[model samples]
Target: MASRKRPALARLTNALATPSQLQVSQALGLSGSLLSSLHYLGGSLIQVAGAILNIPAPTIATSAIIFHRFHLVAGFLEQSIRDTVAACLYIASKSCEFPLRPSVILAAVDTACQDPLAVGGKRIPKRKYTRANTETLDHWELRILTTLAFNLHVVTPYTLCMEYLVSANVDRDRQKTVAQRAWNYLNDTLKTKICILHQPNVIAVTAIWLAAREAELELLDGEKWWEAFDVDTEDMGHLVLLLREGRDIAIRERDRIESGRKPTLTVEDVKARILEEASLSSRQ
Candidate 1:
């Protein structure tokens, strides 16, 4: 969980921004504010990143890699960042619900783009889009990889949870969609980069459990979506602790977002919120 907040990771940060010897902003005209705001407002990027990992075999990692590279080139504000995450998760789910096919992603992208689809960069598979639209996507992907410095193996919430589950011997690999849905929710919060800097494993598990409860895949009617799998006791306990804490963070975030308040979760703020929930839950 060594975060960008850590001085030691400064080099990684620098590399993240490099984006080739070419500088992505120079070509894409992406400004710092636009980039930052995109990350803030667009959770889709993270969702896209998550979806990329599950892109199925034989599909190139190009799109996912490019999207991530774009991040370093452009980070967004908080609200937009969250929305983008939602879009990204939605995309992954769509991709998976189908056959995990690249053609599916392209067809989906094609429908969204209103542009003619390309086959080997020439033949138009779809008749809706202009060459400009197709070219833009292609060009942007190049610059995105530039920002990432070609690093395609970064740890994501999807991968992170999977790794954690496997190491803990929590066997749910065969039931991927169930695990993924859980991971996606947790990954949403990482936009703040707080958990990524510290105690990320705890955060990841907490999200898994919380998603389970929210989705009703666990205890009570709460266990519908994920009963086909088993979670290790150690993983479940850690997940419970983190999720108990996360529920507060999530509530405060929801309230603040609704009330037009700023979303901030300092350590003490989180602790106090959790204590408040504890009292309320105890009474109930």
Candidate 2:
């Protein structure tokens, strides 16, 4: 059952940022913080849907991650792409077995995005999901569906990892600590493009390796950790290597930004500059 492996797999899903997410950030000219907030917003909306529809939290989380992947594939555009929220909600609801009507999902998304739609410190008010809005969401939903080739099944590392953890019969306290870290990792991974890059099981195994390394938990007695989970050593090793590379890149970039040596500024700096430019334009 590989019960001992759950913690690492869950952590891997949440912790590592992916190349695809970086690309989207660059393409959209968003800083890391703003991008992270959007992820939070999306996740919050998913929670709101779950609350409204009485769906299980895990189901909503899984569906939200899948919807996030689809969002990146569809080009994470500005708020003009209102369909982004509704489409994701629609897909997430269905996948989570909540099965919200399109209109209901649209309304929920609209309500969630209001109050605080702050991007770059500028409040982008939520637009009404009128007839046009509904049509747009419907069309965008189709596009997302087609892009995904109608694939709705998303197998994340959490499920199998949990099974292994239970089967291994690890102590409750240790399991809880590892599972929490791994769960955080899984959530963080959704912000990046890692899910689409590898099979969920492979990613899960690699994640377990990472969680153990981070926590300094020696779950394996020997160098052959893959044998414990009956996974391919080479494949698992490769995924771990990729995850390490991703981590290094993120760290370097973070350090560069913090040192204030880079030409680019943080999101706040960018926002202030944008406002200054706008004020100058207004004066002219």
Candidate 3:
């Protein structure tokens, strides 16, 4: 028999093959690329939450932790996507010591979930969220807390990335730039399965590598960048590829939205479509 941890690991490893994943795939008619795009969309929610609340990088990390945990547990059956994202931010804000009003979190959620293609027009939320929705948001926060069992301990790679940059002899001024970009990459990684698959330090180093590459900052000569960290170069390299793929997905999502090739669908739309399809399939 598999150890107790094995089954849980198996479920998470094949996360997208689970019932919730299948429902989403069938509902969205999800291409692999579109699936990647959804993860990117989730990352954007964290970014918006951070910007609006002026939370630190660790708070952003906390938000991702909450976001991923909610999906891992409740999947698509629990709440509307925006509400879930907002609830995650709410919990993260408190946990990370950047408490925000429910209204502020909701506003950020609205901005995060906005379809860029609808820039010139009014956003079509599945429903409008006003201050009156505070009660509903309170309920959502409770649900997320219950689902996560209130275990909010998250050790993000933010600090590890800093140590790597300093050890690499990156100058103070450019270190800020490199660190900021690496921080963004770290937040982005939460949108991918890499978070669950890789160690925090490995992801941390890989984010630095990706940031340095994008900025054309040569932090090391040859492959010496891996020298200081106790991580396998091949594994870190693979993590880099995962982050890069997500970056590409976000870029492509942007391009598609800009070209007006298709209407943008919110999480609600996706969920509704899934329920509709499931209902129809049952009759057939």
Q: How does each model score on lDDT?
A: 0.38, 0.55, 0.66
Model 3 score (lDDT): 0.66
**Taking the tens digit of each residue's C-alpha lDDT, what string does model 2 give over 62-122?**
6566566665555444332235556766776766666776666666555554421221222
Best-matching candidate per lDDT: 3
Model 3 misplaced stretches (Cα beyond 4 Å): 1-35, 116-132, 173-177, 214-227, 263-265, 276-284
Across 1-284, the per-residue lDDT of candidate 3 in tens digits comes to 01112342332221122345334444533345544545555656666656655667778776776676566556554357777778888888888777887777787677666652221233323445576699878898898888766766566777778888898898888888989998878877877756645656678888888788887888767566665665678878788788889767666656766798654345655566546555665676
- Number of clashing pairs per prediction, in order: 41, 15, 0
2 versus 3: better lDDT goes to: 3
Greater TM-score among 1 and 2 belongs to 2
For model 2, give the 10-residue run with minimal summed lDDT. 115-124
Candidate 1 lDDT score at position 42: 30
Off by over 4 Å in 1: 1-37, 45-69, 73-127, 159-184, 190-284
- What are the root-mean-square deviations of the candidates from the true structure over C-alphas? 14.9, 9.5, 6.3
